[model samples]
Target: MNGRISLRGLRAKGHHGVYDFERADGQDFVVDVVLELDLSRAAVSDDVADTVHYGELATALVGVLTGEPVNLIETLADRLLTVCLADERVETAEVTVHKPQAPIPHDFADVAVTLRRSRL
Candidate 1:
């Protein structure tokens, strides 16, 4: 049985941009992570030990997202994917990083980067 865990609209402030102003001032970033895994053991055992803790995953992602300055969202997405895949139970991860207040002059909703990774 495949199970999925999703974390959405995680807010954080970080220095990730090409321009000095963008890097210096920082901005709000939203992260969405989806993890795919087999949960048959957890379901049958009825024990938290048999499954991945979502809080731990969120904390790990926060550490990487806020740890240092990243040049691009692509790099950030890659880092997030690595962090998610670190878990032995996770077979696949889909990460999306959203930057709401970008430096673009024109009207736009937001800028985002999405990446999908598998443990093959």
Candidate 2:
């Protein structure tokens, strides 16, 4: 429960936005994920089976990012949390969804939404 797994800058193209052109042309989305769990077993055993496989998690999330066309990043973050929490090893999962090319009237660096889920 004291260990952490952080996956950052996971970029993928997605067609999710309020504007019609955004959904039509698509844009890059950045994701950051953090998993809280106990890594003592994997630390001592040096086996992947003792812990969650982040690669598989990333692949699954990428599939979701490329598959659906959600209207908001908040919804997407919730969806990503669902995937992150699917791993039994993860006691708590945090998902951050970033939209860099949002339709803002003024110049801005990025927009993002973060959500956290915990297993009881």
Top candidate by TM-score: 2
Can you write out model 1's per-residue Cα lDDT over 75-115, one digit (the tens) per residue?
A: 99999999999988999999999989888899998799999
Off by over 4 Å in 2: none
Question: For residues 1-120, could you state the per-residue lDDT of candidate 2 as single tens digits?
Answer: 379999999999999888889899999999999999999999999999999888998899998898779889999999999999887878999999999888889999878999998997
Off by over 4 Å in 1: none
For each of the candidates, the C-alpha root-mean-square deviation to the true structure, in angstroms, is: 1.0, 1.0
Worst lDDT window (10 residues) for model 2?
A: 81-90
lDDT per prediction?
0.90, 0.91
lDDT of 2 at 113: 93
Candidate 1 clash pair list: none
Q: Give the winner by lDDT.
A: 2
TM-score of each: 0.95, 0.95
